[model samples]
Target: MEQAIVIRSEIRKCMQEEGFTLGGFSKATEIRGSYLSLLLNHDPHKYPLPMRHFDSMIQALGKPEGWLYECYVDECFITGKTDRRRVEPFLLRCAELGKTECIERVLSRLMENLNQLSLVFEIAEKVHAAGNQQGAVPFYECVAEHEKHQHSETLAISQYRLFRAALGQDLHKNRFAATRFAPFRKRLPVEYQLDGLLQLANTYYTLSDWRRLGECADELIALAKVVYQEQHQRKTSKREKTPLNTERHLVLYYGKGYLSKATAYEKQGLYAESKKCIEGYADLSWFEGLDEVGKKEVQMFQIFAVANSYTLEILMGHSYVLSEYTNYLSMHKHEILSGLATILESANKYGFSVDETLEMLSKEILEFKQREDLPGLGWRLRFHYYLSIYFLGKGKIAECIENTLQSLDLSVIINNSGAFAQAVALFELCRGQATDAHLNNYKGLLEEVRKRERFNLGFHNY
Candidate 1:
């Protein structure tokens, strides 16, 4: 109360010094004079001056954004109770202005009563829905921190949102996030569970954690099947279908379940098991309730099945498929990087020649090398590393060192520790053959890694 009164006094003093009456200030700021008078008088019976009006007053007075925000925190409460009408917009404005301290102050007060968790969660959802994902973090964090129920759906949703918002290019951080959110995956609403499991699977895929990836994929498949069956029943019975607000088509989840399982098995060298899983989604023409979007997903799965079938055969030491695979790649330009990586891996493993394939896709390879934000960065890294290995095996030291350096640089950017280690090992093995330029590039990449490590450490410490 005292802080609110003092802040109101400061506002009145500013208005008086600026030689503006309530009507004059209201005319300038377009706020109602009665509201301005009520605010200046610190009327205890009414609510605090809304943040929008406060911001307007600030702009009219030529004060900077977020001026007096700290003191305004007191105004959000009346007689030891939060005024949601006043506080909601205030917190949003604080977020917009990067006023972390002010937001913390308001949240601290709001969390004193555990009943405010829903309000905080709603605000967080609103912020997230508005595309201010980073801004919603504090609110979600607060609710996650204060909620007393361990198995509450609200808590699970908050964890899920945090997991999603935390994801980025950092593999280590992504792994940690996946671990943190794994337990809550089943506790989320079915809709959220589908998306959460998919994201978890993807994160594990990137981290090369095949075992966990298989686990999430299995869960996703099971849940998606049950829901898909129910959806089919609803359609047949003419009942209102329960909305499944998943990020992708429902069939995509079902297809990905099998696809990801195949990938996990392939990674483990279980070619036979991977081939069976590929057949799971090979022809989903019988899948029920497919709209245009679902039909598109089915078509995509068909494409993947064909490509992956070829991949499985190649990986299983059938070098005869190389020509057909290259032809497929020529038809599907989008699949070139991943397809080439698979070809190189097979070539190195089976001692087959991909020189023709490489020459054929030289233009695409050069474009992939130059582009940084391609969808499959890990594939790019693998392609470069494997290409380097092929060059080394053929005794092309110069080309080998160049590809090694390219792979090393990408490994650092993607934070793929395994790829980084492999690239580093390959470079060391051929250090004697490296030209001066290669040595300099290697030194620069090492420095970049060092700086990145230092930054990560500092961020964690802070």
Candidate 2:
């Protein structure tokens, strides 16, 4: 068999195991960076890859003496001098809905990264079995909780969610994903597990498990209180009369517990109770610098908290807190027209319309798209989400669909979980499924807010 031109999976694994980047490897082996990149990406052409470079790669990757031996009996020639007759582009085919052929090809190739491959297989099986998002969450949560990289973990959740929510798969089942993730949950460090447990609790809440949510919220608050008391006293943070450390600890802890209670009450239609909780949560903390950037972020989130209060009001035409926030947003934030802008416009917070929202969003999209690509691509994700909403409100479902797809795409690249969640949720709403799973997600979403609250109380005994 011709030596594998670019066993990309092997190549990537080798690099990862060696703990070396392409640039570092090139420098160490005296190979040109350009040549190394081609090898990593598995360029089909590119002059058949110099033998010297391959030898250097083997040495750098600490390959055994069997370096030049047959690794794959079959080769997937995606392009450039590949064994096209023998191998196939399984991933692409899998996405194209040819799973049988894809599975056959995968089995034939025997791709070694069985962990991720297993996730894919599991996704397909569950999608077939239970037929919705709830079934897949367990598997996805298992994968997500252990993923070292936050982005990958978030992405796996996103992909599974989008696929399930898109096709109304939420109709199949609705239950807590905690048990599914329980096996691997303990494997994570305590801190990491706490963070994930908070999320898991939140997820269950969104699924509408109020009882479980209470338990989760209490646990989170208790944990936060412990972390807090261990750090500093609450008197300083809450009273603003004690040590600076104390004040900050109180603010964060109290904020955590209050926020969760607020969200939970809001979901229960306890409007006054929810608002009170949120108000308590948003109290001026000893931390949170009041700089323009800091104030802007806080105010934006605070607005969302209040907006939750307004949601029931708006649907019932009872009241609206958006007007003041609108003034603040227009005066303090004419430039940040992404999700909030859309939500504002949709709520007519600034007396804007669907048309105005579209115009504002279109402009913002190009502006952010023009900015240097970087991590935390918040603006990009927001623009896409709002654009979808704008289209949907205009009665252009097709355009709405297009915008949603765009939002999902940008959201993934930027890893904006909230924006991604919104778009995915809205997409389900539009599909007319908005089934039990969608409702369940709303419940889960509420727990996320409450977990933060529990963390503040110093202990969730209350």
**Model 1 per-residue lDDT at 370:** 52
Residue-wise C-alpha lDDT for candidate 1, range 1-462, written one tens digit per residue:
777777778788888889988889999999888877777785654657777888888888888999888888988886567788889999888877778889999999998888989999998898888888888889989988998998999999999999998988777687778888888888999999999998988888877788888888888889989999898888789777777788888998999999999999999999989999999899998998789999999998998998999898888879899899898988888788888998899889989999999999888887886556523777788888999999999999899999999888887776766777788899999999898999999999999988777223222110
- Extract clashing residue pairs from model 1: none
Worst 10 residues of 2 by lDDT: 453-462
Mark the regions of model 1 whose C-alpha exceeds 4 Å error after superposition. 1-21, 41-47, 369-375, 454-462
For each candidate, what TM-score against the reference? 0.93, 0.37
lDDT of 2 at 424: 66
- lDDT values for all models: 0.85, 0.48
TM-score of candidate 1 against the unseen true structure: 0.93
**Winner by TM-score:** 1
